[model samples]
Target chain A: MAFDGDQLSALAAVVHEGSFDAAAQRLHVTPSAVSQRIKALEQQVGRVLVLRTRPCRPTDDGEVLVRLAGQMELLGRDAMAQLVPAPGASRAAPSSRRLPVAVNDDSMSTWFPAAVADLPADVLLDLRREDQELSADLLRDGTVMAAVTADPRAVQGCRVRRLGAMRYLAVAAPDRRDRWFADGLGAEVFAAAPLLAFNREDGLQERFVASVVGRRTTTPHVHYVPSQSAFVGLVEAGLGWGMVPEVAAAPLISAGALVEIRAGRHLDVPLYWQHWALRTPTLDDLTERVVRAAAKALRPVRRHGPPSTAG
Target chain B: MAFDGDQLSALAAVVHEGSFDAAAQRLHVTPSAVSQRIKALEQQVGRVLVLRTRPCRPTDDGEVLVRLAGQMELLGRDAMAQLVPAPGASRAAPSSRRLPVAVNDDSMSTWFPAAVADLPADVLLDLRREDQELSADLLRDGTVMAAVTADPRAVQGCRVRRLGAMRYLAVAAPDRRDRWFADGLGAEVFAAAPLLAFNREDGLQERFVASVVGRRTTTPHVHYVPSQSAFVGLVEAGLGWGMVPEVAAAPLISAGALVEIRAGRHLDVPLYWQHWALRTPTLDDLTERVVRAAAKALRPVRRHGPPSTAG
Candidate 1:
């Protein structure tokens, strides 16, 4: 059976607006009209789609339709952009489209915004900052069209591409370096010193310690500072040493604000771009821009095969 | 049948350090000694306490021991402070203590730091900034000893106290207000105009819309700027109208950078202070400071009845 696009759109509107009355206003129709369309659609599907509560929520069945509606909207916008005359060519104002993308906090603070700047002005970004390890979940749940995630595996019906790696260097203030590691950078010194972590999920420091000590080591005194800028600032102010992103640490190291705690030791976190497999102009453009920018700013992935196979 | 304090401390150290060897170093004992203590503790409890992972994690049983260790540490410090003379009086260095507290992003950006400044110098603050709606979850999981949350319900083993409400006003750039809302703050204007949201979880704008239109309304165009400062800046730049915290909107309103879309129509999010029920001196001091600061910065919650029993 053919599903009506208008009914699907109405369902999406109600879910997004959180009520039938609001959806009606947005659709430029009466509240009863909005209610009737939703009822007809539900009857056709023989399934309850939405829970009519304050700030309405989608039932599991409703979510399936909402995802389809969003994907359809994105595709429709792409087709319109290609078919319509360029903005300056006509008196009619060009319409903008919203593109939701999930990104990790570290990437957001470091290099993601610059990549977004390269997208067409007609594409409005609805950026969601999530943990890298969890951003892929957003894609799986249909909360975002694409995500920058640490997980290399693609979600069902999605495609994944390697986006290089973000490198982190163990860094500390000069005085902290002197006070904690005066003897040398060794496991013993690392065990005794206080450390700073982004949060409980931050395991970079522990990993570094494991690499140095040849085993997992406990950090007795840890300070958790969750903000990206503030985390770096606390490190600079001599609060404690931590793993600083190379992008944020390079300038600080040169300016003498931070010093590498251990030379020739760092962690590289591989990142991947995951997006819906649907081939659309906007998603293609976004993917191209992000890949190009990441190639320049991040360390390229080391190929396990010959150079000819690498790209 | 009593649990030894040293073994419990060793278990906590391993969990915190993420490795037995590191815990040993922090405890000033041999790695074998640390291992033996943990083994004895596990044997005594007849449950697997610590998972031997790269960064040691607590099993369900281990988590109980970890929580107990943390509580014991807090209580021990309070006892020492009361029994001993001030550090400077006898020329002996005072040992510092770590205190982990969860706070909402809005509070962290506004008045929460002032409350922290009142904490004793010997107290180290490990501040975890979580969404107001989710901060209480941290307390439930024993990730933090206290939290500033929007939820009035107390987590198990925690005490809850109301701390006024954070007021938010619907605001937009002056030019955007003139262009889109010139007709007035009606449903038609809201449906057509772009809006700003902190993230997908932020429903303040939707809530405000429901309040104004007297029903839930769909916002077709939205820009999600996750950072608090950036979210406000985008609204000021005419990107969209959004619900800005009264604390953040006041100065912008005075500077003429922003205009209120609906005057006198605002949303007040009631906030509550939740902390472990343990009545230690440090926790009491923190509670007092937070309560005092909230009174000065947030809108006072109106009393619903006679003041005789009011807290």
Candidate 2:
């Protein structure tokens, strides 16, 4: 649905702040006007975007449309910037919504948040995470204009660059490692011992185990530790050992809460920086910083390696 | 989704091809309105897109909504280069297509005749192919705006890069690699056996065993042969251990003489490249060369990796 500049800004404020009242105060518009614009936007899309809940949250469909609105704005601004071939493209009129960026949870736990620490405050930041493997889909669907992904391939109009690897280490609490070792923790110990996964869907632990066990199981009594900090906390507390990104875990390990379970065989997830293939300084700058950081921090792999037939 | 540019073309031909009788003969136009609008479009897109399509084409979409009409002329011109851009941006006046390109097979296999090579062929130069992993997608997607690929990434705006990747290999005729030590090969002896994977999937024999046996299927499939020339015919002729990419296999392997039983892992597929993000001469210069070659040579990835997960 197309929205003119004024109308879109008003609606975006209302949605982000969660209320016509709050949005009105922030946008310096009357609450009634904010209500009118949102109603109009909803009518245009033929679906309700805001639910008017206590603090208000968008419906799943509403979020999708809100995302679409955000993309259209980007595209419009980009069009203005590129299509008109002027020396310095006029600045995009400021909007309250931050440029949404989608990234993998692991990267988010590592350098992603830090990447944003450098953005202009007015640029705003919208962060989303799923998994490195699927992050590009967000770019395809226009959920975000930029993304940190495992897939190096570009989306229809996106640019791609290597962001290096996100190395993972198999670590455990110092006492727990010794206990498992002393208790005859053979490979089979993995089949029976308590394992910690970030969530019901997280497979890092299972995959790590299978890499060592040679076979995987469908059922295991697993402790679900959802957040990055929480997952590390659980591991630090010795709930069970899990694979953790070296970046975020190194500092914690030095404090004596955790210890490396095995010294070799790190899992390196190659990461890539992908963004709309537009000629915008902000996007380009973000790409440069990300690529630089990944290069400085992650282990590097030769561009072409001896071919293999294994996953 | 299909537009009736043919009707319009035939009609336009009636006037351009001139003498309703000749235009009708050329366009199979029934003569009446073909004569009428031949005069009309001269007014519409504002230029004579086609003087004739006796096997003829267009003047410009810029003059009007002549997208399909202009695209046909552009594509015909590009049967060689790669693509024609928007109906709007013709610096001075739209003209010919140019610069032929090459690509691999896989990308061509999936992108269909279109995919990345979706741009019209308003320029010149025939699209061609050779490798399947590198520039094929660039050719297909117009990334190199051109390429030859196996499983290589499409050059951003070009067609295919390499077809991306297809792991191919060689297995001897009993006497070839091990002096009749053939059939007894299924177990531990295969990893470092006189193995063959022309480029990389050579450990394939061992990988096959791994699926049938273990993950660290300790086998050493031999050397990397990057060229298709040595990969296939060389392997078929019973040369020392050789692994070939998939595209080169069919004819020779199908003949029932050569046998490749080596198996170890999933072929590694990695494609990469970058292209001019904007529609410019250099970018266009490379696209057609890539896609045309991809269409004729490459194959597709069996499945798109799962729908990319988005936040």
Best by TM-score: 1
**What are the Cα lDDT values of the candidates?**
0.78, 0.51
Model 2's DockQ?
Answer: 0.01
What DockQ results do all the predictions give, each relative to the true complex? Answer: 0.15, 0.01
Candidate 1 global CA lDDT score: 0.78
Task: Summarize candidate 1's per-residue lDDT along A146-225 as a digit string, tens digits.
Answer: 98877778887689998998988999988878888886756667766767888778888998888777787666557777
After superposition, the stretches of candidate 2 with alpha carbons farther than 4 Å from their true spots are A1-3, A10-97, A120-144, A149-161, A183-187, A249-257, A301-311, B1-311
Q: Give the TM-score of candidate 1.
A: 0.63
TM-score of each: 0.63, 0.39
DockQ, candidate 1, vs. native dimer: 0.15
Report fnat in order of the candidates.
0.22, 0.00
